[model samples]
Target chain A: MELICPAGTPAAYREAVEAGADAVYCGFRNDTNARNFPGLNFTTEEMGTAIAHGRARGVQTFVALNTFMRAGEEEVWYRAADDAVALGADALILADMALMDYVATTYPDQRLHVSVQASAANADAVNFLVDTFAAKRLVLPRVLTVAEIAALARQVDCELEVFAFGGLCVMAEGRCSLSSYITGQSPNMNGVCSPASHVRYREEGHDMVSELGGFTINRFGADEPAGYPTLCKGRFLIAEEDAYAFEDPVSLDVMDHLEALRAAGVSALKIEGRQRGKAYVAEVVSRLRKALSAPPAERPAQLAQLRRLSEGQRTTSGAYEKKWR
Target chain B: MQLPRPLAASINCLPLPLVQRAVALVFRQVLARHPGLFDRLGPYANRRFRFDPTDLGFSFVVYPAGPDITVYRAGKAPPASATVSGPLVTLLALLEGQIDGDAVFFSRSLSVSGDMEAMLALRNGLDDCGFDLPRDLSGLAGPFAPPLQRLAEAIRARALAGMV
Candidate 1:
């Protein structure tokens, strides 16, 4: 399977390339892409450099123009598509319906991969995208079990990419509105979830309280670990119980399922974390490269080094295993 | 302690202001080499960062000064737009993108104050800068660059073995 990786910056792109990433994905430094945190992503010139850098190393570069286009703002998304093609992006991962139509008609030859944010779960939805926009690939959402993935693989004609590692959002992408409900900013529209502007951390006695838009999300003890205040991962009081009502603070590590994923007809494994650093890109990519080529029995030992870097120092296979459902 | 460890320690032990001056010089080199990358900051070009490495027992402020980064020993004057405090290694790991910056922040290994936007801008700017210390430092020595880089890598590996 191809090792598709995330690169938030030009330096990270180089690190991913050096670390043996088959492809590195990035977005422009704007809300045009998901994972659009402040100070992240690349500029036009940097994008050109990143593409050239990856090409020189025989690694493909993919640009994500994944966010939905607001009315009257279609031109911005169109321009991003034009630039991605002009800059030699190997593929464009898109989510918005309007943008998909625009790209299919305007740049028919450019490879289009359906972003996971599109939440096209079953084979029918995947087929619709492939038939409609000529999407060359589909990034499956993190909600399907391995059996389900294998089943869908038999039905869909396009290439399939599954997220192999990084932060796990509990909700179906492009469909969740919890962030919009609380902060009035949706990942679909603004490319930000629990935006930094709405985030505030306070020290209340011995515990640290994390709030989003003045609403308490989670509180950590002085010695406990905290996470980014995304609404989906917050702890809440449900039925007189105060617990992680949505999802736990852990990352997705599916290195152990590599063979099974490949067997299930996955053409690529995507690593998340465009907000991370070069060391992260290098470490994750290099180690995964080792695991991918190593003897099957040696894979677990190779992935052990990544646990410390996992969020909250813990990891989950997520919905890849049936038990998560 | 090998070739680079003692040298790195000596540099680490330099008077705080002098160390800040040297860091300022490196920052100048990074900006000069990647002006286009830094230009992505746009309006944030004038923002200042107050970095306090508490474990290292010193602090410094870095800000853009007409296409160059200006660094000085931090003082008790007006607070900067952003202030990052952490152990020296943690800060280095954060700067190198070796770990998740938010993960470190959540783990309480690092802390930030002031304008979060400016902090984000600086973090992204530095990550995009692609400033590899060992490579840049070794390049200054001309013919000795490769050997210097090896030594520096050795010291860095030993120091950062457990950070992740």
Candidate 2:
């Protein structure tokens, strides 16, 4: 199986590849990719260099042209794909159907991978992309269970990729418009969601109140750890009690379940934090790489080491276990 | 000053327009320094937003909720006003000129509504107003006296010189 990793910047790309990623995915500096954080991502020239660097090391590079094309500005998405192709990316991970069509038609030889943003969970959606655009791989949504993955694998001809670690999103990957509804910024349109510009931390009385758009999401005492506030994972009042109603602030770690995933016919395992620093990329990729080679019974030890590296010191199998309530 | 819980809840839920104005005030203050940031904000500043006086916008209403200064234009449908919603920390980060609106929008850290054109316009306008940090932070220093006031005056003088 392939070890696909995120590379938000050139430095991170280098780190992931050097640390043993089979493939590294990144986006342009603009809204072309989902991890469109400021001071992160690659420029056109930087992308070319990064791709060359990866190629020299026998590691593949994938450029994300996943954002939906603007109505009158289709050229932007087109140009992004063209640039990625020009830079010699091994494949283009795409979500927008028009972009897929354009790429499939314009750059017939360039490999295409279906981004999880497409929310292609079932065999039909995966096969549709394969039949129509010839998608080489499909990054399945986080909503599926191991059994479902095994079933879907039997139904589709294409390779399957699943996120094994990092942040967990509660919404269906491509269909979420919650951020745009509140902040006018969207992952589909702008390649961003719950942007940092809207977060606020205030030292109120004995606790630090973390707010997003002036709404209190969580409050932490001085002794507690505070994570960056994203709305979906926030603690909120529902049924007269404050709790994590949508999802908890936990990272996903399925390293222990590698054997299950491999048995389920997954072709690639992806780690999700492109906006993270190089050190994080290196550590995670290296650890996962080791886990991939470890014996099935010994995987638990490696997973325990990874648990220390995850966010909030908590990890879940997420939807892969069919544990959603 | 101490209201009952029910009364406090009612009072806290002010109409959306007032919230918009308060957000506008924060934007105006932060953007006062950069004269070109608005144009740079591009399509993001084109929308308008509505908010109750107490409402900070969707950032507080949604995930990672907190006190936020929303930006939006009026005369739009509910939730469609050209508005940008984020936390005060995010606002401060933006004001420091370390962050961009596009980054915020994409990361799901900021939320928006309404007219895209108006929201973009507002963002661009504020971007144009650079941060006058020294002037804003001067109150934090000292005896609440004339020295800080004089320092603020000197900074203003330097600002005028740079503009000219």
Using all chains and alpha carbons, the TM-scores for the candidates as numbered come to 0.88, 0.67
Docking class of 2: incorrect
Clashing pairs in 1: A277-B97, A279-B97, A279-B98
lDDT of 1 by residue, A134-252 (tens): 99999999999888999999999999999998888879899999999988998889898888777776668768788888899998888687777888888999999988877888889
Off by over 4 Å in 2: B1-164
User: What is the per-residue lDDT of model 2 for residues B46-160, given as tens digits with 9 covering 90 to 100?
Assistant: 3334432222322321110122245332223255344454454455444433344443443334454444345443443333243545555444454664677677667444433
lDDT of 1 by residue, B1-164 (tens): 12255554665577766765677777766555666555546677687777877554356676664544444443543477778877777787666655567667756777776666667777877777665677766766789889999998887778777675
lDDT score, candidate 1: 0.82
TM-score of chain A of 1: 0.98
DockQ of predicted model 1: 0.46
Per-residue lDDT over A216-273 for candidate 2, one digit per residue giving the tens place of the 0 to 100 score: 8887665454444677777888899988777776778877678889999999999998
Interface RMSD measured for model 1: 2.1
Query: Could you give the fnat of all candidates in order?
Result: 0.53, 0.00
